[model samples]
Target: MKRYICFIALLAGMVACKKDTVRKGNDPYRETVVPAIYINKDGISPTRARVGEEVMISGKGFEKNKDKLAILFNGVKAAIISLTDTTVRVKVPAQAATGNVAAQVDQQYFFGPFFRVTGVFEMDTLYPSLVGANGAINNIIPVEDGKYLVVGDFTDYGNSGKKDKLNRVARINHDGTVDGTFGPDAKNGTNSTVASAVALPQSVNGYQYLVAGSFNNYEGVSYVNSVALLNNNGSLAANRIQSPNGKDITVSALKGGVSGSVNNMHVQPNDGKILLTGNFRFYVQPNFNLKTVGTDLDSVHLDSIQVNGLIRLMPDGGIDSTYNYDLAKHMGKEGANGFIYRSLLLPDGKLLIAGSFTKYNGQAVNRLARLNADGSLDASFMPGAGADQAIGNMERQPDGKIILTGSFNMYGGVKVPHIVRINENGTIDPGFNAGEGTDGFINNVGIMPGGQIILSGVFTQFNKLQRNNMIVLNADGSVHATYNSFGGFSAVGDNGANGNVNTVSRVIPQAGEKSLLVVGSFTKFDFRTANRIVRITYP
Candidate 1:
């Protein structure tokens, strides 16, 4: 009886051991629970967005690790703005065609409904028939009735159906068609004219334009050098512009003569007078040889009384002697021939100038200085220590503050990144700070309707974020966190490695539109082929 009992106990032990082994093999902790992803918990907020616009993506199990997840708009990769376990924000890739949104987390792939990606700005490919310029378009001004005045070194303008030989300056219709009535026929012996700057019409009827460049004549007959006033019909105006004592604005490379070209011009807001700045040393009036000058002129001469490079002109083209600011005395020696690059007339009649000079009126002023309406330095407005480098541009805000962009890393003894905002008193605003700012030089700054600022330059990053050549900033100086440039600006066929914009000369916001016109030397934008100029939709 004892042996039988022992055998029964052994059998029970073996059965119990087998049950324990099976339980261990099926341990709950050892079993893999594949992560599941769900999208649009609140339903996709927007089913459509333009390229470069941000779209909100909400879901679960997104994985805390951004590297473990991939987001795509259509087939192109969308740039992640921010990520969390339950939500993600990304910008629609500029290169993305219309396509669906997809997210890959770990080994699982989740797709949302199809989303439409639309273009933000349209290109001017058909009408103006750019064809491509032999030179570069240096500057452009928007005129009345949707026309644009373009200045550059090109010699031809037209479409595939028709071609017009445009000198350096030409007026184009909104569609890029050359305005035949605005100037003399291009083929009429005017082979080469290089206009560097143009000013808006000073007349209320918009019938006149002020042009400055390195040209000795117009229409192969009118002898005008460097400066000329044109009528709406492309003929010389009734009055000729000349130096105070009657000589030409002689600009040459030789010493003792005017040595630089006029780079910019601005018309006074209150008065029709004009303001000019460059590296030249004198200004001579054009000799029409008549008591009352008319459209037709006889001969122009460059030998006459010398004037400073910076000068204000009367409506009739005579130098405004009352508004005198000695450019030579105020602009101290700037190594390598530095000169004023830009100037702005303030609402209060003050003048702000920026350049590479180190002194203003013999006072230690870095790259920026302000002058009273009478051309005297404003002693009350002080910029301490000024900028560490050259200031490229300046824009005023409605609140009387100034926005500046340049290659500078410091301003007024404070570490102000490349872009900075200063109060009307010329003191840096503590509220405006761009941490580390841009990595390259900024050429232009444009303001949007709500005071949002758009910056364009050769920069690759802003505040340590990849912004490429263009970036948008909130009024408070914070990065437009959701703005993305994909790969920014680059030349076409650059193999995706070089995304730097070679140069961005201008950034102009379109009137009554949320788009911006970017003109520069770049041939591509956001990884797409865009010759010299492209319009981007700002979202």
Candidate 2:
């Protein structure tokens, strides 16, 4: 009787084990092991694969239940082409993005190596593979050869274990490698952020860079405030004049470099004068009033004049009195009601200024105004009603039409989304129809020789099509379906909680190439890690 009872007990235990196996197989959400807690023993073959391509994943337990196993690439489910005891071949899904590959068995995931998605508009892998800037890159100016100068608030560039402490300025080659020879002496590129930059015409000593922002100094050179000139090697450029004390004092900045932040800087044609605009109350200069002062030598005092957000400087860092010295006399004490974001120099010497201000020199310009060469508001180039919001950027076409982009949904009272074209006289150009336009504000625009427009900013859709943060539009303002259908930029929290957190601040087309040099605060492009800068090419 005892032997028979022991036999029955053993049979009952076997039945219970069989039942557990069946239950676990049917429970899709039940995990015998913890989910998302990865064991790093296995990896995927080929590391990177394009959409619809087959990749082999190597790991144990994949063959435990081949029909029940679920393979995924970056959360997108992939189709299993074949399976074995220690390997599984799966095809990447069309919607699969660049991320880790995972295999799920009984609801527990085994993570594999990070996989990159490739195709058109993908990040140029030939470029530096390091994680990009530690902060936002506000501006990029093309320099000699295929290199470019980039400036922003960042103090470091590159990934961990390999980084360059470049401060706010850095020069990069065509392949995106930092030029160590350019700024070897500037341990710290700038004391603060650099907002705008323009390259001066190549002189006998290479290229001079005019940089403006909130920085008060470059390296140890002080009192630069918001503007200064940098030499080819990224050092603060000094004038040839000697100080009153007979010592050769290096003075690279204007007396006090205006009084506040400079958002835009431009070099005039034929003349090397620097034109700057931003939010400032005055431009300060060294006052030589009463140099001897009876007996004791007078200490150099700074003299500040209320000029209100617009000024021009000679190449020698002195105020260009001939341009707008009496600007207050013409435009009142409040030159612009708000900040001037950008200034475009025209061939005819007139200037197109755009910004947040609704009034210029007390005239109701409404965020878009044309200034005569003398700096007074041009009343004839009237933009009736103008932009209802701030104009962030401007682009001039070969046909002389001005393209304006901003946060405004209406231009001159017409519902024209975030972008519009205007005639030379500031009247709206109806030829460019943006349909519903971009869903968000546009930061900048790059016009191609073929009339195609490249736009980038805080947007996900153009004309109701999914274009992400960047898009190419036909001249008539229709989406370039073929170019945008396959691949484009993507961002974190797109169309969700984080609104416009990631942006493409600028898109510059290579002078004679099909590639675009893109820079901004973005962290991704085409679902891959691109950091703040990327060079993407279209087919």
Candidate 3:
């Protein structure tokens, strides 16, 4: 009995010491020691990776004994693409929501303790294609259901004979199919009137209002020179407002007015006020209830430069009088000389406008400027980034950084073409360089929720290593190794007589899984389709 009691006490004390050792987090002895994970590679992971590429995970920690090693994905058995004594590689599952996907490795040690480990599987993509036309995409907004409304001067796709049937707006589906429900043979869910640029579209007044601007005069016949509203279905939209100033101009008569030419526009979400910008002397609102004379020449085509200012339309589609101002003087009279084509409403209730100009408000400013909603210029916002190139498109990253795309070769004295990210205050990000020996132009860019940036335009390679046209760079500015697959590329140039029109105009991401919208003049898509606008997905 004494011996039995002694043994029981001794065993209990040993168990207690082991438990205390682990719990105390201090004693090295009596604690289970895990073998440190290492790369059988004897070096760090390779930095350069092509899309859809995978990395090897061969190492001694787990592979030394299959009986002791096991790997799992999100706690489930991992779908191993490949593995060896020194490496293990896995494919990233698709449509994996914006979150972390963990790779865990558990290896039992011959000495005693187990080695449990984990890592991450990063996924992204890069799409490439032949170049197309040269133009800015204006007024891209989503419509009811799954339709998209895009208004621009791209009358034809791939030089094909596709007309802007109902003015210039076309309602298309996520799959790149035109919605026949919006126009005649072509349906635009906006106004039938032609505005150089139109607002996305909204349901207002007795009908849906699609605001449009003009460059010429309206003869009430075919030469329409004013802003017009069309119904929800691209029919001549009508707005019912008590012409605040007791005067109203019908949409058709805006051409001959004071601000006859409206080249760009912005709609206020707060009050549905329409801001029309163009090269005009002062803002003009139509008093169509009176016999109004149209544009200066009774035609939409005015050879001379017109006024450069802004006009405000009330929610009721009537002109707002009490709230009005001149954009020319506001944008710095001397600097607001060029046409304003791109405008974005910043987070701080200010407006940022970009165009072809070297100065703003008499001060040295590149092609971009910031304006208060009341037309006052924001001085603090200078050439935030891409100071070297002309910014073709800029999108605010989820991290509040700015991703600018344009044609400026020398960035920070280093040649990183196609894309560049700027810090919040507009400083060049050195850590996020796409690396050296790269060339091409980035036309458009937007970030998906997962922090992966999808960039499109024209480029043959990235990271001085990979080939991708529209590529999704990792959040760290590195090529997401598990991006799109590697494939052969065919170099294409304009075979047409008009050489300038043959380049990638832009690339638009759609709402479907691995779905994208590519707009360019290349009739041959991925060496397949002859259409200018195309939809591509993973096979």
Candidate 4:
């Protein structure tokens, strides 16, 4: 697929600035401003513009006279056609070119007066980087080719002798170290940038791509909800993008839905646009009264909040507003204390969102919810009417059934925990039922190619034996003993440098590969080699 990205920009007054410069070289002249993101519209499909058509895209950091802005057909630079206040007119070139369609810029600045820009570069394929420091490297994810992008939240501001203070992203070297590539001493301080990412690269439309999400700060608050990118190492590739005007955190949340805590992210079924789920809320109150109205609360200054139970993004850096119609919205128990922690997108395009909401779409639901393609509640498919437990991981199996794992004890009328099979209508599929599954919680779930189910979380007694933090379940929700500890991938290691990892957010299971990719907050897989990440394979 064609490689593309958005650019960093300002809005309204944010775009208003004053600068003076003396032109020297052939570089176009204009006022300089920092961009938040970069963009390229290649191979993305049904784009806002076509091959021969023309369109005007206005964004931050733009100048008409100084920046020699040009357009391209498929990356071919057009001739010096025309220019204006905020828009540039040029014929699309016929072929592909490595250089720019125009030079968008400023006359002078610390880096340079003007910056020449070009269309998005198409990347056919690229290997993804596996990034984790046990819990030592909080939110920094390693992108492909030795670049470290900051997921933010790292209290350690100075590292590699960089004391200028840093944001959340930076560039590192191939030796698992910081790269001094973009700036002189680029040290992104804590909270300056933030993102939640994994190391696995995915193939899309026959081309390879990277997936990431964030909780950026649009407001001056601690974490205002945002996400960005870098290659493989830590570096600034683009400006951060904010969520829809209000959405910050999701459906059901752990706590009462904080300001910016998007604990996890996901990908959509058909078009891999990227889905983010954590916890979102509309208002915050002190006492634990979800319906505390007309009780002096109206006069008090309350925090108006919005938790993003789920959201979709466009490749060209726009929010898929249409998705809000297809996904869950204004859901939860119709009070201040409702939210969504995680989700599972099914093969049939339906969504299974789990967290702590007691109602969905004005209907009575427990902690789990089933939504249609257009974001309305699935009234027929109901789960927790009696055994109301939270669903941590929901994955479909080969036999066309869903294996749900989480910290739940009862669902409907049966006793199930750690694992259960739910039919398409959200009822327990009696054909694949086991009395009571696990004695503890299952943070994540995956189906191995060999038909075994991999489970991870804070469990000590999985079947009858003593399991560490992970266990395997068979097709019928019983323990799969064959691959119990079959691989030495998770042994034991020193975790003094790492912190406590609470949840196993995701599990990547492939059919042919001998192992599966596991992710969580734990410092080690089990005890193996400081393994914040490890591949579980058979002997």
Candidate 5:
């Protein structure tokens, strides 16, 4: 009986030893814990991107085994460029649509918010015939009702296959087609050149457009050298609008030849007074006769005749003498005179003017100056030494900061490349630094809805970064690292023998949309065939 009991105890000890061996051979903690494959909270760096653009997907538990990991954009498989335990870089697939981005690690799956795949440009059709090889779209203004007013040296528009005459000015529909309702016959609208056109906030006798250029006649009317008002139908407003001196505000070359034109115009938001600035001297009416005056010119007459480069006028074309800044007296020396290229009206009833001037009202102001509401130079606001060169353009930020760009190399005493920001007090904002700004001239500066700045010109590089003729900047003045899809502008032939010099003349951002109207002299962008005008979309 004792032998049998000892045998039973040994059997129990053997069972216990077997259990310990199994536990030692297989540890519960040693089991491979497949990390919870997922995406980071910030799904992608650029929420909007195009095909062939690289986007990063970040999440926890992304294993290094790329073979077992996969990225899908809108359910379309994307090419994974690199993969790590925490991040995954993938290129947008061509078949990808605007939808949620997902990842698959072996059998486990992770998803993110909808990633928007926006088109590279807004307008799909290209208006190749609008601009000649040498011509360009100078300005494009977005109308209140989803239309656009385009003015430039072009002579035609429409598709290259079937073109139509467009003169120097024409209204374009939202789809980029010529508006036949505007201008007569869509062929010979304006007789001569039209430099700038503005839509009046308050219509005058049913006229809403004020076009100024080197045109002498519109709809067969004579003695109209520079300015003309257009009716809603795009024809010459039946009621004639005359300049202050009963003569058109003639534009002349800075060197000394008379050719009536207007560089820019600003309409007051509060009172509808029009502010005109350009190169003009005396406002003279050459042939004035009261008896032979036509019905259009009967009511309009000269109130104050002596006007210089800048002048303000009433809605009825009468001179507003209440606010006068003697542009001639404040302009620079005798030979090299100052020219106002741009102006801005501040919310505080102040005016900021910039150009190629070294003094303002004999105050030794540099290229920029500020004026009070009464047209007196603002003594408190001053930019010491101003810019080294002419300020081509200026854009006011939402925060009241001013962005000035041009062919300048420095502002005040600091090295500020071609772009600089100034505070409301006219002092430089040191925090806004554009390191080694654009290498070439900056023609236009536009602000995006997202506060990013879009600049275009003859620049080949910006802030030591390689960006062709155009670039976008963050609100803090840093180059957008992910915005580099434009392959840069290049001349077609040797030394630009084809008459295209690769220039971007204007950039207008569409309100309430992530798109831009880019007009330039280039026939290509991002290595693709594009005309002088194209719409660029931002993600």
Candidate 6:
């Protein structure tokens, strides 16, 4: 009986020691010594400073030996002019950039607040100082002779002195001044929104534009449907005829247009035909009684046919009869169908489209698919399950591979966060890996001449690294280190104070590839007020 009692006590003691071991293993102080260089939460003074300037840092526990103390401005070491236990004076390094500041003492380090490095990749102050369009600028297309055509929902551009009361469309010169030679005022522009504008190729129409949106009228003429062709001076393309009284009258010649909004427009390079994609359902055609009114059409009579979010139009804005619309409309169900958000025209006359689609032409295509020249689904290119979510944008590489970005975390059942690369055969590329992908959504992507990629959206980090809304990825899908020096876009405060949150809708490389034109709903980029549009130049 005594031996049994002894064994019980011995076992209890062993269990007690085991618990003690775990307690010691988790001791917070075991591996932690007070950080030798203690920097307060807001230790850096003047938060923003230029290179070759001096800034003061306040901290405690700094090293007593000057040689053992170091100050780093965003990973770039700065020269310490003087140092003490409580304060240190330092000169910003030439390579210092916009990021967190840190102090190092021996092997321990302490971090400080973020510092904005000015005079590097900054906003073009030469851009018109007056406030830009009152609303968002949706699209910026570079036109002839260093001019840009900007289209959006804005009602006014610039201040009262230089402001133009334009409705949705305007031309800005290379120096950021509104070109008064473009069109009339707001009273004569499109009645509603102009969502997209594509320049018609010279083969189709000389120096003309194909604008599409929800507007039903342009220049007070009601015959223009959701799509219209505009002349070089931004007026609706019309035909002038002489009446019986010998007076010339202009009438719209575009008889048929789509009934729904066109989100994107593409002019085919091989042919002058226009390719449109959006959430539309019908192609509208109007029967005009020229005998009743020589200058206008009878608005009461119209004709419409079923369409499934994709259509092709000839140079005259008439539906293309040669293309097969029957095969394109078989999108799983009669009423319920998928909608395409964007499409890319391949060099071989094929089309690549991505959106929230689950099937195409009665076959399960997930969200991405390829179409033959005649609008039939290409069975050869197959993405087993495709993207698990919506693909916002896609860009083709020079080598025939494609880069896609969206709100998806998986592609074809594989974990490939917000972005992925697919081969021409519709298989995920094994060579390009975006490690863990981005933490937030990527809305736009642009591939540079050397294969580097530019991604913009509402993301704060990419691949677990701290990059603001914009980041440049190498050819193999790794973050470009040189892009780090140029700070990205972000809001001002902790909760995006002053309504300054950044969202890049599109990023297009300029002609020389030496700069990028970034357009979005942003009020700030790199801690500067950019007002929705900014040009980032590379030296």
Whole-model Cα lDDT of every candidate shown, in order: 0.64, 0.75, 0.48, 0.45, 0.67, 0.74
| Index of the highest-lDDT prediction | 2
| Tens digit of per-residue lDDT, candidate 2, span 312-395 | 778766776666566445321456788888888888888889999988767788999988887878889979989998898888
Residue 221 lDDT, candidate 4, scale 0-100: 29
Instruction: Tell me the tens digit of each residue's lDDT in model 1 across 248-285.
Output: 54322111112246666777867877766666666565
Every model's TM-score: 0.67, 0.73, 0.57, 0.52, 0.67, 0.78
Q: In model 2, what lDDT does residue 397 have?
A: 89
Better of 3 and 4 by TM-score: 3
Residue lDDT tens for model 6, 1-539 = 99999999999999999999987786675685655667777888888888889988887766464678888886678998887788889998865668888877778777888888775345566676236666667778888778877777666555323233777777777777778777764344677777788876554456877778888877777657788887787777887756444556565666678878887888888777887778788777765433345544323456776767887788677787555465455321232148787788888888888988888766788789998887778889978789999888898999999998887788988988889999998899988887887777787888877688888877656776566677777899987655555567753444767442336666666776476677666667676676667777664
Instruction: Give the lDDT of residue 462 in candidate 3.
Output: 58
> Which portions of model 6 miss their true places by more than 4 Å?
1-56, 60-83, 88-114, 118-122, 158-164, 203-206, 240-251, 290-299, 327-336, 490-502
Q: What order do candidates take by lDDT, descending?
A: 2, 6, 5, 1, 3, 4
The candidate, 3 or 4, that scores higher on lDDT is: 3
List the candidate 2 regions with Cα displacement exceeding 4 Å: 1-119, 158-164, 239-249, 253-256, 287-300, 327-334, 485-499
Displacement of the residue 71 alpha carbon in candidate 2, Å: 18
Tell how far residue 74 is off in model 5, in angstroms: 30
Model 5 Cα lDDT, one tens digit per residue, 150-241: 77776665532223456666777776766767766633446766667788764535537777766666666655546666666666654333
Model 3: worst 10 consecutive residues (lDDT sum): 110-119
lDDT by residue for model 3 over 218-297, one digit each (tens)? Answer: 22323334455545565554333333345433454123233455655667777666666655555344333332256332
For model 5, state the Cα shift of residue 362 in Å. 2.0
Provide the RMSD of all predictions against the true structure, rounded to 1 decimal. Answer: 15.3, 11.1, 22.7, 30.3, 20.7, 9.2
